[model samples]
Target: MSLVRKFMTVGGATLGSRIFGFARETLMAAALGTGPMADVFYAAFRFPNLFRRLFAEGAFNAAFVPLFSKEIEANGTDGAKRFSEEVFGVLFTVLLLITIVMELSMPLLVRFVIAPGFADDVEKSSLTVRMAMVMFPYLMCMSLTAMMSGMLNSLHHFFAAAVAPIFLNVVMIGALFYALYTGADPLTTAWYLSWGVLVAGILQLAVVYFGVIHAGMSIGLKFPRFTPNVKRLLILAVPAAITGGITQINQLIGQAIASAQEGAISALQYADRIYQLPLGVVGIAVGVVLLPELSRALKGGNLREAGNLQNRSIEFVLFLTIPAAFALWILSDEIIRVLYERGAFHAQNTAVVASILAIYGIGLPAFVLIKALQPGFYAREDTKMPMRFSAIAVTVNCALAITLFPHFGAPGIAVAEATAGWISTVLLFVTLLRRGHLAWDWALARRAALLVVAAAIMGGVLYYLRGVFAASLASGSPLLTKLGALGLLIGVSMIVYFAVAFLIGGADLGMIRRNMKRKASVEPPPPADL
Candidate 1:
């Protein structure tokens, strides 16, 4: 299959997950709002979620896939299977120890690392500690699931790993439905959500485990050993972990800082969920598919193919994300009001969340671009450089969040995250170019500039339409009226952007068909040493 086809396959599954994630967040808004319980739950959840990103999605896959692909190419399927089992044994053992330690230290973590702002509030801190303990085990399940996902992606089996996330949203949505049906209090509902997260992790792991098996790769358990391959993995993974989870690390810091305010943490989270749809679908699909493909291209000694893959992935990401960013920024208020301005989620909360969402929109392409760019280094087993760049980004994020949060509140944190993302993206791009690893695709550069213009044009249309449908999007409007208005706005914006993009030579069916029909364009073989 073509690169674009693989991206779509993974992206389509991710779209399902993101859609369910929207449902889950909507239910959560109605049930929890920005109340104390909402703050407690989100704060608790961010800790485990941060670790999950670092270990499962970020570090493991970045380090594992390339190495695993090399093993397959050099030593065949048996060699890869043995290597997987070795890593799994070590990973499982380490996770067990970490979970035990974390559960024991949950209170101290909440008081210090997770939410120092909750320290003075005895009740909130205690609740956060308990809830965090319940959810922290989720890190173990998800990390294991990530390992299996790496295996699946290497084997060109993208569906299961991509689809597995849907269960997390589905199970949580089910929990929310139950809480709503029972009219449970926020505290009880928060409890339900925490347990729901744990259950979902297990289910997700099971899903991917079966997927690995179906792909004809059976990995059996073994005792932990510090084998040479495992040692090499650790060397690569330690840095990749930091680089991979840079966004999460920044968000965790923001969460800690935001926890000082009453509703800041919850507000940032709601806004984050809004923008994550595009980021997850476009950014993640590109990252997941591009990394392994680049690894294979490089392994086969095809430099030009690797360069084309990088350029096209960036092109694909920008083509989708630029317009998405504009739509979100323009429709932020309307989207928040239509989705969350009911029950406990008041109009005041909508205003705050919408502003944050708009700022997040500004950074969407940067965030996704980081995804498209990072594989250039990871595919070559060069994890340390990205890790150094991530440190700079994180430092920038910390400084900005501290300076801005006091002045502008939650939206300030959004600004910091976006700025940091763009900085990291530029660093990666420039470094890759300087190292002669990434070639400048002038066609991609020109089209990206045009796509931005198309998005700006669409943004103007959305701005006018929002005023036209202001009444329908108002808090007092009926739910159906709000839904219809928002749907029409989105539908019209998509049409306008795509039409403008195609007509103005930004992108066309020809470009897309070429991408979808393209295969690895192999050039000269590498030197024997390489």
Candidate 2:
């Protein structure tokens, strides 16, 4: 399959997951709104998610895939399986220890790290602690799941790993539906959601575990030994972990700050969920496929192929994400209202969330670009530079969020996050260019500039159409009417963006076809003769 097709396979699955995520969040908005319970639940949930992103997904995606691919190249499937077993054993043992410690320290973690804002609110803080303890073990399940996913991706089995996340959204949606049907109060609903998260984690792990088995790898437990290879993996992973989860780390910090205000955490989270659709679909798909593809290309010493991969990936990101960013920015109010302004979610909540969503839109491209660019360093096993960049970005985020939150409220932190994102992206792109790892493509540059113009045109059209359709999107509108109006706005925006882009020579269908048809030279060659 072509590289673009591989991306589509993963992206398509992610789109499904994100769609389910929208449903889950919509139900959540109706059930909990931006109330205290919403704040408590999201705050508790973000802690385990932070660790999963910071450790499991980040470390394994940046470190394990490359190493596993090398193992396949040098020693074949048998050797790769052995390596996976060793890593799995060690990962399992360590995760168990971490979970135990975190559970015991739940109170301090909730009071200080997760939501210091909740510290004074005895009820909120206590609920956050209890719920966090319930969900923290999810970290262990998902970490193990990430390792298996890395194995599957290295073996060129992308569907299983890519599809696994849908289960989490599905299970949670089920929980939400059950809660609503029973007319459960927000506190009871929050507890149900916490347990649902843990259950979903287990289900996700099972799905990927079977996927690994089906992909012709039967990994098993072994004694947890820090072999020379394991030690090397850690050396690479420790830095990659920090570099990979920079966004999450920044958001966790923002969450801590946002927690100081009631409903701020949930508002940020609602806005986050809206933008995450594009980020998850485009950014995540690129990161997952690019790292392994780049690793194989570099390992085979195909510098030209590696450069083409990087350039084309950026082109793809710009083409999709720029328009998406514009749509999110221009249609934020309509989108939020259509999706969440129902039940307990008020128009006032919609206004705040929409403002935050618009700022996130400004950073969406940068966020996706960061994902596209990082694989350049990770494929070469140069993780520390990105870690250093992450530190700078986090520091910038912290400083700005602190300075702005007192005056601007929740949207202030969104600005900080967006500014930090662009800064991080520039650092990654420039470093890669200076090192001659990322070649400047005139085509990419021209198209990126034009794509922005096309997106601007789309944004203008959306701005006008939104005003025309104002009554349909207003709070008192029927659910179907709101959905129809929002869908029409989005559909028209897509048509305008694509037509304008193609007409202006910003994007070419021919180029897209070629990319989809282009065969990648990144597949592992046969094992070297022993």
Candidate 3:
């Protein structure tokens, strides 16, 4: 399949998952708001997610995909299958051990990580620690699930991996509803959410396992043994682990700082849910699909093709991301208010969350760009270069966080993160260019600049419309009126952006259409041998 279509297949599936996630977060906000319960739940959830990114998404996939793709190219199907089984056996054992250790140490982990926020409230701190313990085992299930996802992705079976997250959101939403109806206490509800996470992890694993099987790959555990390929995988994974860990550490630092300020962590999290929708759909989908394709191309000594792929992915990301960033910036408040201004969540909370959303919007494109760019290094198995650049970025993030948090509060932390993301993007781009691995095409740059101008115009129109509907939005009496106003704003923004983009030659609708058609006509890249 063509790159655009491949991206769409993955992105479309991710988009559905993100929409369900939005529903889940909305329900969660209404049920728990920015209270102690919300704080505890967010903290508990972050632990597993942080490690999952560090180990599974960052370390394992980064190492596995390229090596697995190479094995498929070099040795054929049965060889790749044997390699997979060996890797899986090792991963299973490692994760099981880590889960046990994490569960036992959950109290100490919570005390160190989230203690600043609960300094004055010992009771809440204790409850958060307990809840964290209930949730820590989720990391093991998700890590194994991620390994399965990596295997599926390598085979170009994007649907199952993409759809798995939807199941997670569905399970969480069900748990929230159950807690609401059962009249459970907030702490109990939080525990239920934690348990729901473990269940969802298992379900997601099952989904992907079947997807691999359906793709004609029979996967099963093998006796663990050290192999040359396994050693290579470990070597490649270490730098990626550090790189991914640095990014998460920056987030953990932000969380730690936010915890000191009442409701700050929850506010950051809520705004994050809003920004994450676009990030997950466009950024992650492109990154996941691009890496294996680029790796295989490079392994086959196709430098020009790999370069073309990189440029196209950049264009694809910027084309969608520029407007997404603008829309979120313009309509942050309206979106937040519409989705979350109910039950225990009040307008004041909405205002704070919206401000943070706007701040996050500033960095959205940069973050997505990093996702597109990093694969360039990873596909080449040069994880150390990106890791070095990430170390610098993380330091910059820490300094900014420390400098700004005292005066600007939560928004300051958001600004710090945004700044760090742009810095990292620039560093990655320059390094790639210096190494003669990536180059900027004039046509792409012109198109990107034009898209920015178009997005600005769209933003201006949405700003004006939002003001015109402000009174009804604030009155909050009629739900339909509020939703209608929001829908109108979104409609105008889309129309204005697309119209301006097309008219100004900022984007080629015909090219996009042709590309989509081409994507439909082509078959997927033949599955990797295993």
| Tens-digit per-residue lDDT, 378-475, candidate 3 | 99898988888888888888899989999988888898889888998999999999999998789889989999999999988988888998986774
Tens-place lDDT digits, model 1, residues 275-339: 99999999999999999999999999899899989988888888899999888888999999988
- Rank order by lDDT, top first? 1, 2, 3
The predicted structure with the larger lDDT, 1 or 3, is: 1
Please provide TM-scores, in order, for all candidate models, with all chains considered together: 0.99, 0.98, 0.95
Q: Considering every candidate listed, which one attains the maximal TM-score?
A: 1
Looking at model 1, residue 441 earns an lDDT score of: 75
Q: Which candidate, 1 or 3, would have the higher TM-score against the true structure? A: 1
